[model samples]
Target: MDLGGNRRGVDMGPYAVRASGLYGMLKDLGHSVTDGGNIPVPVPEEIGVGA
Candidate 1:
């Protein structure tokens, strides 16, 4: 996972994954695929540390 981004909505990594066609490409190469969807992100407050 990323360190997250500077701005809100910068965490849109799942969209990037689909746009990059990672799942489809992997499946075409004979991989067993399933879209497991996204992981939950922590709220900034919960981090309790930052740069």
Candidate 2:
């Protein structure tokens, strides 16, 4: 898969979610929920792009 350029944004999506306070918003909607926190995933450095 050739990821030409502009691939950095995809890697930061998860961090953006935490920054946006999604967990808190959902909890405020009067629904029981538990945020298990971020899942384990490898960064681009750890797993090099194979394009």
Instruction: For candidate 2, write residues 1-48 as lDDT tens digits.
Output: 214555657656657777898867878997786766666755567786
Candidate models: Cα lDDT each: 0.77, 0.67
TM match of model 1 to true structure = 0.46
Please give the range of 10 consecutive residues that has the lowest summed lDDT in model 2: 1-10
Q: What C-alpha RMSD separates each model from the true structure?
A: 5.2, 5.9
Those runs of model 2 whose alpha carbons end farther than 4 Å from true positions after fitting are: 1-7, 32-51
Cα error, residue 49 of model 1, in Å, equals: 15
Per-prediction backbone clash count: 0, 0
lDDT of 1 by residue, 1-51 (tens): 355556666567778888999989999999998887777767667777653
